[model samples]
Target: MAESAIEVLGVVRPVAQVRHMECGVVLRASDAVALTRAIGADELLLRVVQRVYLLEQRCATLSAALDALGASLRQPRAQAGAPNAAPLEPADASGVASEADAPQRAQQVVRCAAFPRTLEKRATDTLHERGFLVRPSNYDALACLVYMHGFYCVGVATKEDFGGALWEKPRTASDRAEGPSEQKRARAVHGSQQLSEDGGGAAVEAAAHNDSAATRMRQTSAPVCRAYYKLKELGSRELVAFSDCSVAIDVGASPGGWTSYLAERGCSKIIAIDPAELRQTEPPPPCVEHLRQKLQDALPGLLQRKGLAADLYCCDMNAAPSLVVELFTQAVPLLKPGAQVVLTFKNVYPKKRVWEAERDAQLDRLRSVADDVHLVQLFANTPRECTVLCRAKQSTEQ
Candidate 1:
């Protein structure tokens, strides 16, 4: 009940504090006063409920222990004077159930989970007065305690752990002068109570609001999928430019997210090629052409029939980097002298050395065809993957 009302420190959601006690069962308590007020329960009534819940949990734990012990003891016991024979020890004597006595411990405790919250001294003192032992904890000891006990233990974190959790430092006088916009933005991004340390050890307020403006801008003009965000990062940096009537090609453009983005940015005509089905919320604009086929298979016919010479080319294929280079090289004759090409390089190798080598090779191939090549890790990309933006040289040079 206390967990229900008391907010979990360093977390935005309070419900995250609720811990499971067993399979299909949960135990939650809140500050007595808060619980009473919320449920219209008097102090005595709350205490009665708390006692009942505690009794139920103890019963469940005891029942599971007895079941495990019974199953173990059922196995053939050693003869009266056998070398391995030992006297039975009382379960309550050491406050520990031995593995020899309880091999089913894992099964017994599998459903149980504990909730631990770092609390101020006053709260710990209150719990202690109510007969709860609030132990002090370091991150390492916390895991050991939880594992040894087979249940949750409430404890306070060490100074180092506490310091790490409080990431924001108090803003200076200059920061306050930056205006309410920053403060408002921080609150919008991080819903949690953010505190920065002051000189006196008191906490000052700070929020993760530095990128609020960009987040808002993105929300207002949200694109179809995550692909839009990658392109937005590139476009916002002025990495590539597009004109009103610029012809473009989107290889592996299944879903047409990039095609839609290009259309909105004033590219007059686009050849979107993918063997997979295209998914769109609405029918595409007249300038857009969706070819349900692979880029390699369709490019030659498209070039011959339409005399296609694209001003912009985009590809995001999950294939080898060498294949990507070959695709661009083959399409060079159908690209304008300085056509812009934006592609993604996926790091398929698990090892760092292999990944770097593959990436470097891709960039080298890219440089051979384009005068300028920029490889950047886009926010939308997974670990080690990057987006490559380049401008193709003339066919004579190619």
Candidate 2:
């Protein structure tokens, strides 16, 4: 069909068959460092990239191919300095690397500002007919492919270069829309997946790197700040079972959104601890007890007095994960045996090491005091974070 279309237009198709197709990938600009490290270890990718990458084939095909290569896709990572700067290769265990290294090359960029409606529809349909997965043109994925390939041919006109084409007169919406006859083609191609919403970018980037930003928006519509969505998802998934449990200690609980969520969820008592002032809610939910002191400082005293033993512990500290783990480690003895701990391990700070390094380091610290550590990328989390749900191991068991 593609050949027929070109022939009908008196145009010649490129003779070279695509032995390997390049796919674009988008990641959280934040977790790029660690995710890059993981991608480096995998051999399936023709080339790994930051904002986008070139996969050898569809994600499913690559996974199978990866198995044959004795490798698997790890999340891609990024360099610490500039956003556009080339990322460094992973270092050895001791934070050291051999001096002999090749420098990274400059990347070509593609910006698809506009394209004609007929061309867009034909390209979409042809690719779908050939079983070639193309991320929607709007997504960063297709743009990456266009950047790497130089020009992505869509329909009537083949864009020769990125800069000139992107700066050309923008096509009107009606000019961009599929004609009545071609609308089915548009829908057919769209059936594969949407790059911006769900596609290779989400599969490799979010599943490998982090989750969607849309998740937070979709899961909640509360008046509270975005932080409220995190706790709301935690409970909705039964990840923490806050409603099933009676007492929950919320560390780093400023803004009181979690407290409010807990109160609404029917948690009998919520001890919200933070140094910052919490926003006052009307009638102030009776179950929430705001403690305006640092959890590290206040929790230890509570432990000393043997006054607080909670069924669950939760923290969403903006501090380093290691520090949060340390504070919680000391307070583990104050938690009821087999109580749950739900926390967010965030890549909130700049790091010299990969994200796994920080996550493993924190988990190591937590293991000494707690157990059953499972790190999950929640729908509510952005690319920079993950939710950790664990239980305080029975003192006698571990």
Q: Look at candidate 2 and tell me the lDDT of residue 223.
A: 32
Instruction: Report the lDDT tens digits of candidate 2 across residue range 200-266.
Output: 2221222211113323323433335446667777766667777567888889887666666777788
CA-lDDT, candidates in order: 0.48, 0.48
Model 2 scores worst on lDDT over the 10 consecutive residues at 68-77
Worst 10 residues of 1 by lDDT: 139-148
Best by TM-score: 1
TM-score to true structure, per model: 0.47, 0.46
lDDT score for residue 272 of model 2? 88
lDDT of 1 by residue, 1-398 (tens): 44444432121212333332111113233332233234332322221121111111111243333332233322232211111112121335343333355332222110011222222333324333433333321111111011112322221122222211222222222333343355444332222222222111111122222323223322443345446556656676677775523899888786566877788888888888888766554655887888888877887688786567788988887776777778888878778888898888877777889888988988997898897898877545655468988888965475
